[model samples]
Target: MASSLHIDLHKISKFVNLSIPALFVVFLSAGHFVSFYFHFFTVAFLFMVIANFFYMTVQKEHVILKNFGLMGQARYIIESIGPEMRQYLFASDTEERPFNREERSEVYRKAKNIDSASSFGSQQNFDPSEIKIRHTMFPTPKEALQPFKITYGEERGLEFAYTITRPIMISAMSYGALGTNAVRSLARGAKLANIPMNTGEGGYPEYHLMEDCDLIFQIGTAKFGVRTDDGLLDDTKLAEIASKPQIRMIEIKFSQGAKPGKGGLLPKEKITDEIAKLRGIKKGADVVSPPYHPECDTVEKTVAFIKRVQNVSGLPTGFKICLGKVSEFEVLVEEMKRQDVYPDFITVDGAEGGTGAAPKAFLDGVGLPLLVGLASIQDCLKRHGIRNKMKLNASGKLISPRAQLVAFALGADAIYSARGFMLSLGCIQALQCGNNTCPIGITTHDPELQKGLVIESRAPRIANYVHNIEHDLEELLRATGCKSFSELTEENLYIPSDTVLGNYRLNSPEVQAAAS
Candidate 1:
């Protein structure tokens, strides 16, 4: 009886499918005979339907299209817009990954210089797995908090040692990774905020130098702005870049948090004439940087390279890395000690860091998160008795003052925020940074899209966002009974017993010693 019913249903389905097109033809014929306007409308509608039907049936690419015909097209249309629908209509404020509505809204509020205080209780889940800040009975006065400042290369006695007054500075967002307008606005904003900006490895940093802001020239594996024809570091070009008054420091990037082992990928579609000229690459092809520097293949070579860059640039020089294997870092540190050639600073980019484009495996599965990496590195440096030799800068999803405070407690000397500043310039978290279709023009190079990001309007917002974060940082510092970030210790942070951080803390010798 079931088999017979299935057969009957199949026949009925076929009949309905055939009858719908026949009915459409009859309607079109009637419309043609009835009225000219009706005929035109029916003809246009039928043409679209017929074209879609034929295309879906003939298309062999999608299995669903071949099987379900026009229904598959409808499904695809709905699926294509699923992200937008979920983001705007269905997803809760705390549901989204990377950045949720609540987080983005906080940044937006701060960027607009509006009050970002919450009315109701916290939306955060206070589960046993959550980390919390431990408050003391006696809170420190706001006036007692010291001004935040970190001097790079001061110990090394470099001629152009740079002092950063703010703990939060804009992280590396390259020109080719971002649009021209976006870069200029960020530079202007950095100037207004009195914070330094890292000129990402996109070469030359023309736009970054246009504004009167302190800049850190980054040299990627590709050596974009300061590379020879064979893609090796060019000392002459490096010195020239360092000579710029705005160029306060130079960072040799080993790897970023987003793609620790993988190189940066700039799509061919986004590459323009200016980007090509600056990067010293061809304009018509995708630019894939090397995974590691050609000259610094071994631990010994890496140390020598740092010293070489520092000597040639005549400025504070550092290296950035996303911590992977602890033993590998131990070897590097050991080598640095042997050679007595330490970088001025070490930027530890966490796995949660943002990037324009990276493979899913690297982005999601690779490298250590900020707190873990920062704490591990701190422990290692302290154990090796080199903690005070160099500054430890942290980067990854550190947008809020609370987050920055946690980083401070974990041993981060300074913080770098890329997406935070991007949000200040009105990024909608569209997740189109990889493509040349950023709706807000922050990431895309498309002229039409770039127009949406106005430098004059957006620059001040960046300044506002920085100022607000600084203000909140002071407030949070006062609440913690700490005079400054320098005073924040791991004891101030309470990690859940069942969490990964808790496990690490339990295993940490430092934590164990403190408990003993």
Candidate 2:
């Protein structure tokens, strides 16, 4: 009887188990569509019936497991259901601890324009730190004020100085990994918020222009996005893109949080003709960027090239990177000290971020956490006495007020978020981004797969999320008694006292880098 039951269940699944009611629930709840719902159900039932019929006849489980193994089968069967499992087990409500659950909820509430005030009183479990918290004077704040503009270079001149219109902006995640609608929606949202969006190493995208969004185009190691006839950065090519009103900043990518000092990869399967053309590589072949740039090999040359980009573009240009050896940063700062050429800004990205696809070793081992890296860069500037010469921005997992505030307190002029924005656009963190099979349609080229993303609708949500976060950030700044984000100092914030006494202290820079 048990054997018969298993056989029947298998048959049912193979044939018309989609008749199982859940499939039609969305349709039924969608409208007063009693007839249409029934029609869909009937059609679905027939489809499942045929499917089950084949399944019963074939009965190939043993064959599948033998040929594909558990891992392979999991990809299709168990993994296909991974999203459902995560939603049911986890929540939009449960806090992510350490950096856990309730914390994420507060941010989501503020971003969604819902009440962020906790009901069961404050969620904090602060154990009374040894360090006393500090408050500020002139608590009332206004929008659109001074020093809110991020200044990068004084010696190099004002043209190189840049502004971060809002503390919250979109960080880099290339277009190839994120679909057309996703890019469009994000750009539209950034335009509405008057913040900048960093186009990942994928280069300048046309969809970014369509939305009239301000942008920071990233230059990867291979110089993939903007290239000369020899596939290097072309002045004309840079100018053509820079001439547009929306294009705002440029960054030369040396390394990232997920995999610093590693080469880039676009699997052979993803090397579409269009992507190949945009990146100036060939299609159907695995695309890899050299481990380093051919031109900017030395620290001095890197700074020189940065100036070349800024000189030609007439817009802010800088570098987005993870802090590694102090010696290398010291060398680069030494070059800046000698040459008087400064990048418009420096974005300190943390190791907490993700990549399209990177080796497990690099992902786990390379780069520094955002806090350490940002603070290191800040200290470098401060110690070098050139702190005032460049704007410092923070990237990597910055979304909520606390995260933004932390960055601001740590001396970052602004913070940028990529995955968090992806979440606001309805990503459930399925972790399928690099595979070209994102169920959310944020990362794929297949037309059939792109149906899930609706640009016009999702675009507004993105805009709404950005607007809410920016306004709330202003509120937090006001509550802390600062007039502008630039004026916000470390005295306005607090951290766990133990964290200072612990491992963080060991990693702290021995000599502060001078900031002029």
Identify the candidate with maximal lDDT.
1
Taking all chains together, each candidate's TM-score versus the true structure is: 0.93, 0.77
Identify the runs in model 2 with alpha carbons over 4 angstroms from their true place. 1-83, 90-111, 121-147, 151-155, 158-162, 228-231, 500-516
Which stretches in model 1 have alpha-carbon errors above 4 Å?
1-16, 28-38, 41-49, 52-57, 265-271, 282-288, 509-516
- TM for candidate 2 is 0.77
Model 1 Cα displacement at 477 (Å)?
0.8
Provide the lowest-lDDT 10-residue window in model 2. 64-73
328 in model 2: Cα distance from truth in Å?
Answer: 1.5
Error in Å for residue 391 of model 1: 0.5
Residue 95, model 1: Cα distance from true site in angstroms: 0.6
Candidate 1 residue pairs that clash: none
